[model samples]
Target: MKTKERKQEDKINRDLAENIKQVKKVFQDCSDVIYREIQLSEHIQGLLVYIEGIIKVEDVQQHILRPLIEGLAQHPQADGEIYPLSFTRVSLSQAQSATDWPAVINGVLTANVAIFVEGMDEVLLFSVKGGSRRSVTEPQTEAVIRGPREGFTESLRINTALIRFKIKTEKLKLLDMVIGKVTKTDVALAYIEGLAEENLIADVKERLENIDIDGILESGYIEEWIEDNPSSPFPQMQYSERPDSVAAQLLEGRVAIFVDGTPFVLIAPVTLWQLLQASEDYYERFFISNMIRWIRFFFLFLALFLPSLYIAVTTFHQDMLPSTLILSIAASREAIPFPALVEAFIMEISFEALREAGIRLPKTVGQAVSILGALVIGQAAVQAGIVSAPMVIVVSLTGIASFTVPRFGLAVTVRMLRFPIMLLASAFGLFGIVIGAVWIVVHLTQLKSFGVPYMNGIAPYVPEDTKDIFSRVPMWKMKKRPSDASRANMQRIGKSRPLGSDSNEGW
Candidate 1:
């Protein structure tokens, strides 16, 4: 059987007998496909159709059954009439085509009724779907030091509502589609109606409609599928657990996607600099923000190339070091048999293994395992001369560097790429390090996040955007919107001296 089954090809003047007959054959053996045939007030005969798990029976009983069924008792004259009812009076456009199969599935999934009648050609839909969901709670990742602690939930509707609560403007438009034939996942495309560029909106919608994946378990699947370059290590879309971040992006005219079953929402048309920014940067004082930004930048480089630099510097460029420093390094390496490359790889890979194991194991045991394993192994290796004490120091610093990256997903990519760069540095010394950095930079320059260049505000030189890239300038001085993703309406808030502004102050 196909994943999606349609009950009706198109509207037909209903012969209740004929319609019910067709619906049953298509829904064969589906016990949850409930069909409750009853006269509305026993006056109008119609059938209520809905799948079981997707709806609340109590809502059906209270709103639908109690209203119509109880009303029937009050008006004995209307009993079993089957021709007319006041509830039918609510819609003058009752005869209009209800919706397509996808919409029907959407309504059913959301606890709606597809009411079928004897004479009406189109179905009447009523939304009543309800189920218990966890109330919006603080984000585990991307925790805030200030502002609303609530984050996106697994429910896509709830997530949209969270965004709507923050930005109540009518310009906040939600465009939706179904992806993943098997999962039939709900994907929402949200952007400000006026602020979002027409071309960018159209491009995003086009890409989504064209996707034909078997299942979209989370937003990452959609992000990966729609990205411009599949082989690129960098993320084109930024994922966030915070709704305010998404709201901020939407206000700036970037599109946000919320996938069902995942709390993390994906913000498209992002930049490399955007990934480096932590929400905390906005909350903190500017001086602290700038300091933190530079610190993160320093570590980001260290994370990417520290081990390789250590290996290359020690093994291939010993002459590059001063006499005293060279002797100290030579004394440490005097007993070890392995070259810098092998020594670095052994310690780095071991640290990585411990880090990964800590995450996968239970919270109680995972931390213990990682800590004990690292301490014990590093001590033993140094004592046995399998690796030098300095080698342990280098590996530890590299691990710390990876943690300093702001975005977790980007940090992961950094970790995965670290090895390859280390390999090259080992093979060709300092020359390989420069070649690797150049290759990464070249690849980044070509990558696009949605239609916006990923490397923009850094490369191709937009000087104004630079203030917000490596460091967060005072809010008043950041008078313009980021020009990277935005082409129209670049100046968001007016520029003024940050010196005297109440909201703008020293870190």
Candidate 2:
């Protein structure tokens, strides 16, 4: 009975009297949905509907309400497009002639005012979207010293406009669609036409269109649905709040997915190496960027394998350490009651708990809490003989190493995989650690992101595309985009000698 009543209320009628009743009933108890009825002319009337916070009050009064009251409705036009009004632009919608009631509701909800005239069987959609959207701010998580500071905000149009401002090209195409049956959220798929592979674009579009969910609250939802390897610990899609980062990826022939109401945008056909890169890498000098790149690469391995290495060496291969170091480690562990594995698990879990608490708590207090917790907990655990000093040192180093990773998603993956590797090391010592490492490598080799290999240009190996992989090379030396991400438009620049400019200047 309730469902029937709701469906009936959604149906718009030609009779103005009946339509007003149905519209009011459908939006019952929703105070934000405002309705204003005005006598357009002596015998004609019009109903204006919009959400309270999403629209500009002055625009409605000046553009919409003024023209109707001034006698434009004296010769009311049946076609909304031809209807002369004070408004600069208007779109005509035939919602009364369709079953897509959700579209009509969504248009109004997103700041398009709906006008239903007394005699017309259609609604005029006016665009006067205005609200207190967040201004562009620097991305906190992906801060860069040399690159542009502006970042994507929760507003989808603003985010897209940021990208458009950077690219400034007709080749950049954005395909829009509405996802979520209940939420009816807007989603935009962006890519460069000639650069991005045709198959990649089609694959991304297909995956997005096939998603059958009640709502997509964030880009993560679409990412989980569309990922080629959902079970893999490695993130198949990259996320960034920086518009410059997105523009760079688009130029490399990868597609970007923009979801409404979130700052994070999803980039597809991402590789493990790409996730490790920072926007500043391209902004700074090649030598400095390469040094930072090498440091990140070293820390990545340290974060993943440092704890496991300590567990394996201390438990089964003490000979791997020097005589003095072995003696020192043994003395440090003398008061410890638990074995190496148990001590590691306890300290690692404690560190993880503190890290999470730091993130959840207030910013000023979070840092202090995490710092004090680590110092107090580590010292107390050692004093109580629950954990050894050496184990504490290992965990602290591993935790520090994890933070060095550029992407939080990859850092999380590393953190998760650390425990499993530690468990394997506890069971079979160094041999088990090796086995875990091998398994991880094999899994990465098989993984793909929207049909592009997750380990692209490495496991399969592309020589020409390796210039900016491990280290940043001089810009003049690099002339082609990554082959794996772009099958077409591989050439980036014309070939030239580094000193050709000097010679051409007649020096």
Candidate 3:
């Protein structure tokens, strides 16, 4: 049965009318598909098919239709040689010939004009790429004060070109493939040639090719499908909208996956440290960067453990606190009906809901609603004697600390794990928090991103990678790419100038 179906597959027919009939049948309900008939000469006719809004109408009018209409006086023979000879008179640079219906259909769908002629068994596809798309703008998610202002747009070629502008070298290889059975989304795997490991590239390629989804509308779809562990709450791959961030990752021997319609590109084999560091970290001075990085690390702990610690300390280990502070907290909670754990849950949940509402609301009102809502509700709750004042302060601090993490994905994971840690602390005090921390550490140590460890620099303990893991050292002192991802060619910098040297002595 499969053999018979293969043998009966549709091919381009020599009869122009029959081909048009088949194409119209396939696109029966698609009103956007436009079909135009052109008279080439007294004996032969041609059919032009393309989608309405995607193709450039001006190019089709000037380059294709005008040339063919004017060349009618030449009066060529109606042979296989005639179509090839006539196409030369046109000025379009990107053109290809397809012998089957599938290829022709795909070409027309992807911003190409398909030309069908009489007495020809193939269709000519001319690329006239144009459409209304979002222009390049600053990335709203990964905004920075000291970095490039331009962000990636939705167009795949434009995104790749942006990266190319940063890394101007032939060694930056972009391997393209089409995925999704219905959407046929264009995806490109980008990495530097000598920097990235051969096996790592092959593994990424194999994982992508193995996906058999119906459609991919965004990079997140690909992220969900090709990630190392779908069940893990921690993100194995980092997604960024900034071209400089993606280019930086590629230079570090990581693979960047670009999907057609999303501004965010997925970078594979990312470590926990990479997600914690922001693009501005590299752009700023090393001393300032190190200080800010240390502050971010301190707040990261607060974001995850502040609520749980408050519960554990107030409920089980009150003696650990200073007597005056403990007395103040006790006096504040005198009128509260709920226990410490229950009060913390109420405040945390309410705060999270307000934050989510702010995000989901319109931009003009979202920030106002989030800020005002937090203030109004916290004040009302305190006056109503529902939640203690200290609990409110802790929840507010936690929310603020969460914003400090550079990567939204990792921040979300930390937010999600907070509740369970709170529950653990309520049941078993500080020891419960210890258990949860140990479990998370174990998971991070064991998790792999495209065969590279999630905590590559810390758990595996590569001495060379430590310079940029916890604190980024000066750019001049860094002389090697990360060893975990780019084992083949590790050196990325040469000898640096001495600290006080005025002469141009080193690169």
Candidate 4:
């Protein structure tokens, strides 16, 4: 009985709380000193503790110092003391303890400094949590031709405010959690209370509570760690850098995880449709949006399979291509000694390399690389016969197709998964490509983002969730919540809009 109780106590001890000993214990063996100091004064006495860099210097000086300095000027006291402040009540997490580093780190993550009062062994935890965040600006990746121009900033508070500004619903609830032992990364789980399912909430919270990473730099860490099958190359979590995208997810009853220091917020559990979707689709006319959506969907396959199809057709399925086209390809590869696969690898890898180098290089050099890559390399390679003209065409088409994929993570995955499919097709022809595709589908079917099915809605065939999936149905027509999110309130818009429901007058 005693052993069981001790085990239970240990479990409780490790959980998040407003305790000093636990925090210090949590952050132990650190290079930085986790100091706990107390100074007395005639006016007031309190604790002053902080980690370097994490806290803003001016904020501590102006807000924390002015009052404390004035109090010390009036009230002179010894090092060992305790006193209360008469300033405005600051709303934040407060705790008392002096134990372990892990617990201390957790305390600091809660945006509190460890303070030990003179008389009391109990420590004081101040709520002065402020971190440096990037300024809000236009989203570079998700840039829109005609839509809301604002993008999400790195600040969690600002991101939440953006969502709040959009939905403006009391039902929108943000549940905050701190993950990682050393880093103590701030993670906020935002969802609509009525719309989100209780079970899913519990499941998400439970899964998060189980995380044991040392540091969490971005939402990707949480996404990678919490996924049901991390081994799968396909991304289970849907990530977006735009506020509108996150707002839309929240409206669909999906929970958004906001990690400090990253503009990207993760939404789960998502279907494949969510990853394929671009926020720009909804901002435009419905007809145009549907057409673009179809184009993107078609090109996504094109990007993934174009190169492989070229290799397979030239190697095995020669009859599939037109005789004229065959002659042109034959003319191109006639000078090249290497097979289709080798030629493809040389050009594709060069293109990918040039693409990566361009991003890393300065503006002048990058633009030069782009021009050289799109024009110089392909043309030069075809002229030199290092890669066939047909291979160059196939790689060029694939690159363009990849550019059209809206989701950055999924786009990267598409680029990554392409090479293997190319190799397979080179060996076994069309049969190899089919096998690779089957493998992807089977893996996707088994994958889960935070325990939510990856292929939900489309595969399971939930009709209610189809409104915003492939095509952006008219706003008025999307009357129900997306089903995969397992929201509690399935109905979104009823006979009335919640905003203007309260009428002014009968006249």
Candidate 5:
């Protein structure tokens, strides 16, 4: 049997009264929506609908209501005017005829004013969006010493504009999409047309279309939904609050996902090495950036394996340390009651709790709590013979090392992996640590981001790309983009350096 077609299809009614009734019914319980009936003339009438806090009242008054009513009053009886609407008379940046009822409803909800004339079947949607939004300021998360201070704002349009501001080219395309069935949150997949892989962009679009969640309040929702390996501890995508960072990634043939109401924009096809590199790396000289990159890499390893290595060496391989160092460690632990593993766990857990407390509490007191809490707790634990002084120092150093990782997502992954590695170390000493590390490396090599290798240029060993991975080689030397993210037009810069500089003088 053929199913009956739905009677209530989204068709605009010709009669203004019917349109208003249907719109009111659709927005039945929505107190935020404002509906007003305007007298275009003595016999003619029009309906205006918009949300209260979102739409700009002045723009609606000047561009839509005033001009619309005044123009209609003068040309009440146009001889052959189609719909007798003066679309050009309005002062809006953009106006469109919304023939479908869903479009009109969406327009009103998304901070646009919808105007319906008495006889016209379509309503005019004016672009009068205005709302309370955070102004562009220095990004709190991705702060840099030398770079553009401006960051993305909560507004989706503003974020895209920021991107456009950085890359003023027609090739930088922003494909807009509305996800979140109930929320109808706006999302944009931004990429350079000639640089970003077409297949990669299509894959991102497919994954986003597949999401059927009720709402998406932040970009993290999309990140989790579309990530290549959800179960893996490593982040398959990277997020940055700084617009310059987004611009840099876009220039690298990567795609950026801009979610409405979030300053943090997500970048696809990220690697373990990319997370360790910082924005300041590009701003500083090559040698300085390379040194800092190495420092970050070293600390990243320390954050993940330092405590476990300490436990494994002290408990199973004491002879590995010098005589004086071993004796000093033994003296510190002489009064401690718990074993090395137990002591490590106790200190690690306490430190994590303090870190979380600091973040969750009020900013004014949070720093104090985390710092004072750690110092007081560490001293008390050492004096009380609960944990050794060396153990306390090891945990403290490990906590400090985690902060050196530039990307928060990678930092979190490293922090989570610490526990399992520590357990393995306690169980089988250095062998267990090596086994766990190998397992992680295997998982990362297998993971894919939109079909691109998650650890691209590293596990696959693209030697040409090593300059940017382990070290920030000079900008002039980085003439090509990453192989995985870009299929064509890989050349980013030419061999042009200052004439007097060593990079160009010999050539």
Candidate 6:
């Protein structure tokens, strides 16, 4: 059965009737598939095959149909040979000829008009890539005050064009591939030919080619398949809706994976520092950027350990707090029946549920619902003596801190790791928190993203790369890309120059 099917798909039949029969059989019950027969001349006939709603109807009428009908009427073929319609008549730039049934079917499915001429064993494919897709708009998730407002859309070509607008150079290469057995989704791997490591690009391509899936509807599907460590809770590859963010990563010698039908593009060989940093960091002045980054760092810790710390301090080491503060906390919990651990768990779980609910609900009511729900539930829980007020405050702060982290993937990972740390604190107090932190650091050090260490510069202690890690130095001061991802052509900037002369300082 497989052999018969393969033989049928191997080549196109010279007989137009037989070819149409096979195509119609394959596309049977597919209402969107359109087949229109056109007489090229008195002796020659051709069939135009395409899928509706994907190809441009106006283009078909103006460029393909009308032009072919008029052009063929003017030049009658005496030899009865089919004229090359795609080369001589069609205005479309993207045109190809295929000699197999599978190629013709694939082209027709992917917004291309396939012309099957009578007595010819080849099909002419003209790309008319058109569909109603979401336009480029401000990214909903990764909004910035100082950077480019335009974000990637669901269209793959539009996303690539956006990146190309930022980095206008021939050296910026985008290698395209078709993945998924059924969907045949278009995926592009982008990188600078000289800046990105050759080995890294090869490895990424190999992993992507190895994907044996039926369909890839989103970038997340590719992310899961190509990442180095799937078991790690921490995201091995960072995904971003902002084209500026992806362009910045490319400039830093990292490669980006653009999957069709998703605004989020995945950046490979990501580090913990890259995930923590936002696109606006470079857009703003160094001083302000550094200040905001420090705040984000502080909140990152709070997001991970605030509830656990509260559980540990209240349950185990009450003496660690100031006497007055400890007394206030104890008094708040006096009316509460549950212990600190139980109280903390209840508040944390409720806050997470509310947050998820807010995200799942429509935008207009989502924020309102989450905010009101948290406030009402916290107040009622405190008044009802179910959870202490301090526990509520801690959970609220933790939730707020999670939002401060720029990347949603990293923020989610922090939120997930929070519960485990909280459980540890409940079991072993501060010691457990310390142990959890150590384990995380160890895992991070061992983790890799496309052969680059997840902790990269910090764990290995590369002095050159540290310039952008803990602090945001002036762009001129940094002369090289991160050492882990880019192996050659490391110098990205020239020597630093003073902005003003000492003599003109007064001015």
Q: For every candidate structure, what is the RMSD over all alpha carbons to the true structure, in angstroms?
A: 4.3, 4.1, 2.4, 6.8, 2.2, 2.4
- How close to the true structure is residue 275 of candidate 1, measured as C-alpha lDDT? 90
Per residue, candidate 5 scores C-alpha lDDT tens digits across 234-295 of 88899998988999999989999999999989998887778778999999988899888888
Ranking by lDDT: 3, 6, 5, 2, 1, 4
TM-score of candidate 4 versus the correct structure, residues matched by position: 0.81
lDDT of 1 by residue, 1-507 (tens): 333334446334357676677667656898888888867543346677788877667877766666555544123334433433334433223222263444544555556776666655556567665566667899888876776798989888899999989998888899988898788898999998767788888998998999987989988888887888788888888999899888988888798988988999988888888999888888888888899889999999999999998888887998898999888888988999999889988998899899999999999999999999999999999999899888899889889888888789899999988888999999898999999999999988888877688888877789888879877777777767777666777777764554557654542
On a 0 to 100 scale, what is the lDDT of residue 411 in model 1?
A: 97
- The all-Cα superposition gives candidate 4 an RMSD in Å to the true structure of 6.8
- How big is the positional error of residue 266 in model 4, measured in Å on the Cα after superposition? 1.2
Residue 378 lDDT (model 5): 96
Candidate 3: the clashing residue pairs are: none
Q: What would the TM-score be for candidate 3 when compared with the true structure?
A: 0.96
**Where does candidate 5 stray beyond 4 Å?**
1-9, 71-74, 78-82, 86-88, 502-507
Number of backbone collisions per candidate: 5, 0, 0, 25, 0, 0
lDDT (Cα, tens digit) per residue for candidate 2, span 165-248:
999999999999989988888999999999999999999999999999999999999989999878888999999999999999
Q: Pick the candidate with the highest lDDT.
A: 3
Model 5 misses residue 314 by how many Å? 1.6
Candidate 6 lDDT by residue in tens digits, 103-163: 8889998999998887888788989988788999999998888888999999999999999
Clashes of 1: 5
In angstroms, the error of model 2 at 243 is 0.2
Give the per-residue lDDT of model 3 (tens digit) for 1-507: 987776457678889999999999989999999999988777778899999998889999998889778764134656534645334577889989898898999999999999888878878899998878899999999988898999999999999999999999999999999999999999999999988889999999999999999999999998888898999999999999999999999988889999999999999888898889999998998889999999999999999999999999999999999999999999999999999999998998999999999999999999999999999999999999999999999999999999999999999999999999999999999999999999999999999998889998889999999999889887877889887778888888876656674552342
Pairs in clash, predicted candidate 6: none
lDDT of each: 0.80, 0.86, 0.90, 0.74, 0.87, 0.89
- How far residue 356's Cα lies from its native spot in candidate 1, in Å, is 2.1
